[model samples]
Target: MSQHRKIYLASKSPRRRELLRQVGIDFEVLLLRDAPPRGPEVTEIVLPGELPEAYVARVTQEKAQAAWDAVLARRLFTLPVLAADTTVVIAQEILGKPANRDEAISMLSKLAGNTHQVLTSIAIKYQHQLLQCTQKSEVTFAPLSDSQIAAYCDSAEPYDKAGGYGIQGMAARFISHINGSYSGIMGLPLYETTDLLARLDPH
Candidate 1:
């Protein structure tokens, strides 16, 4: 593999880092406190009349642009910068990170014994060019009992996850089936991301 190019990951997600590492993609994490804050507005937290796909895509773009700006301002690495945002949707309802244990339980209950969509949007910026893509995965959950929900919520895994659960964590027992990219649901779509990067930086 050609190692002349550098890649900057504009995210603090360890899961994303692990995913990239699994594919042997050499990259460095970009940590800039100056990056734009993730607010309810930018995330579009299930507005009264908003679409789920559009909402997630918008947030992904916002995050990518913000990271790009930060990298440019700091004169960081000259290679491409990657950013992504993931959301869980059930019956058109976007379930983001819960604010408290009660809310986490409520979100888990809503997803119990049902099929939901996990949408992940990825954006890549290099020089003046930008590329964005959204990948969707359908995941089926087994009927979750109250005790199970409580136990999962009490764990530290669900606090920072978008759907109040992590597929690779304690919640894996609750997942019956998945019909799309597992890596995408985890936060980054490796196939699409690698394909795009190959096109941009073919060695």
Candidate 2:
């Protein structure tokens, strides 16, 4: 809960950084050397019959492990590395970030008037110990009109986030209900994150 014990956050997500900052957890962003391709993203393809939970957990572990190795490779000293991965699933299908305006509109259209799952998996590695957990939240979206979808897509917020929307952004207007951790839906679950850090002190 103090800045005295800082960790390295292995992510570029502003939302995750802000969440950690708000909770008084001091952290520095850790980037892979030469901007290497994220292990999961390098494939951009999920395995056959892989469930949402498995996919997210695997990605989080890969990210955390990669960061840990990077710390040694870069000789960045001995600090814990925290990483997370979030994904959206509807009707058993994973909704990825849209590559074009059309896909964004499609993702939003399917999410409207439906309940979808947002799963975020967090991983923390310190020395030889590694800890990981997953948070699953169901988000119910209100029925949206074509104009509303178009307006949101035009805002350009759907291009970089999973499931084509950020709950903390304008997309909040489209959410009717959420049955899980808000912070988890945003990107990071503070309760789980704090617990992991306490159990495995970053020092």
Candidate 3:
């Protein structure tokens, strides 16, 4: 097996890209333009009765598999593919990316003065082998006023993030504390990710 100095990132998220670059990992963003278009089945739709951890891991694995197929189709370098997914859960109910400002406001309203679980599942695949893991974080929010929620909804960040918030963004003011990996809340768990790479590398 050939060792890969650079891996293929299967996400377009700038946060994930920055996280990898910040750690000095050389990676190329896999462009779906050349890959076969995906259907809604490949999307992050939570299944009925699916727990947060299960949902996140399933989504990450799905993404990694799709990216691997794309890499083969594009005949790109024989590099491993990395993919990840993050979601928020409160009272066992998943709160995904809000569709509109109204929904963002609603999600934030429910999260005020509440603690929720943030799960980020990551997957890396090379040939027939696949390595996967999940990072779970508990984030507590300060009591928020309606005005604060509305003000945040007006901004453009919430729509693209799960639980209608980003821990590393302006939403940091809303978070009182986090009990687990901070990077995991941002969508990728840096420690777990680096560890996976080190273990997967055949050097």
Question: What are the Cα lDDT values of the candidates?
Answer: 0.84, 0.89, 0.89
Cα TM-score per model = 0.90, 0.92, 0.93
Candidate 2 ranges beyond 4 A from true positions:
1-4, 33-44, 201-203
All candidates: CA RMSD (Å): 2.8, 2.4, 2.4
Clashing pairs in 3: none
Error of 2 at 189 (Å): 0.8
lDDT of 2 by residue, 4-86 (tens): 37899999899999999899898999975433453332234688999989999988888898899889988897688999989
Candidate number with the higher TM-score (2 or 3) = 3
Cα lDDT over the full model 1: 0.84
Deviation from native of the Cα of residue 65 in model 1, angstroms: 1.3
Worst 10 residues of 2 by lDDT: 34-43
Candidate 2 at residue 154, lDDT?
97
Q: For model 2, what is the alpha-carbon lDDT of residue 81?
A: 92
Q: Give the CA lDDT, 0 to 100, for residue 183 in model 2.
A: 99
Q: Deviation in angstroms for 90 in model 2? A: 0.6
For candidate 3, lDDT tens digit of each residue in 1-203? 12567899998899999999888888999854423454342677788888888999999999899889988988887788999999899999999999999999999998999999999999998888789999999999999999999999999989999999999899999998899998899989999998888778553
Candidate 2 local lDDT, residue 39 = 38
Ranking of all predicted structures according to TM-score, beginning with the best and ending with the worst: 3, 2, 1
lDDT of candidate 3 vs native?
A: 0.89
